[model samples]
Target: MPQPATGPTEANTFPALCAHTHLFPGARCRLQGLSDPHAFTAAPWSIGVDLRFSDDAAAAAELRTGGPDGPVLAVPPYTTGAGTRIGERAWFVREFTWVDGEVELRIGGHA
Candidate 1:
């Protein structure tokens, strides 16, 4: 059986585990809610998820099958596109975007 992924999202965690059962967080790793929609963050590889909520913060995982799955983004990429106009509650992100020296992913929704 595949063990539930533990610890942060950095690649370092797995390599150490295989060597000496040791794990540590990585520079790009973090913990988040599974099904909270806002809990999901887009990794380089796309992960299957149902229901994305307000904002592009993090995503939450859903145990059951229903609704729609979330799309993979560049963590906090800009949502600007040709003819792009977001509703009052639309979400988007841009690479290398940050505020107060911390990264921020835009979160919003459509009317």
Candidate 2:
């Protein structure tokens, strides 16, 4: 995920791209640039990724410190058998109302 410039810079917004979509909360998301296969625990878990969001503020703040402070990116949640056709790669949504300007995601699958 790329950060927006504080001064004069290029515009990076996804207005026309993600025109029609539901920006649902509590979705599963994965951050990029940090992967560790050997950092395993007793049970199978996500590697260098966060899988859930919450309405609770304290719980969300606790989870934020679990990883390094890079540009957090996520894959938008999808329903089962919804036929949403998400492609192998897609751009992460750079702005949203929730999460204090973190780069949340919108689904933009290729045809």
Q: Which parts of model 1 are misplaced by more than 4 Å?
A: 1-96
> lDDT of all the models against the reference?
0.24, 0.25
Kindly list the per-residue Cα lDDT of model 2 for residues 1-111, writing each as its tens digit: 222232113222111112123223333233222222122111112222332333211111111112333222333344323345432222232222222222223322221
RMSD vs true structure, all candidates:
16.0, 15.5
Candidate 2 yields a Cα-based lDDT of: 0.25
lDDT of 1 by residue, 57-87 (tens): 2222211111144322222222322333332
TM-score of 1: 0.18
Predicted candidate 1, C-alpha RMSD: 16.0
Please report how far candidate 2 places residue 32 from its true position, in Å.
Answer: 17
Alpha-carbon runs more than 4 Å astray in model 2:
1-80, 96-111
Rate residue 102 of model 1 by lDDT.
27
Worst 10 residues of 2 by lDDT: 56-65
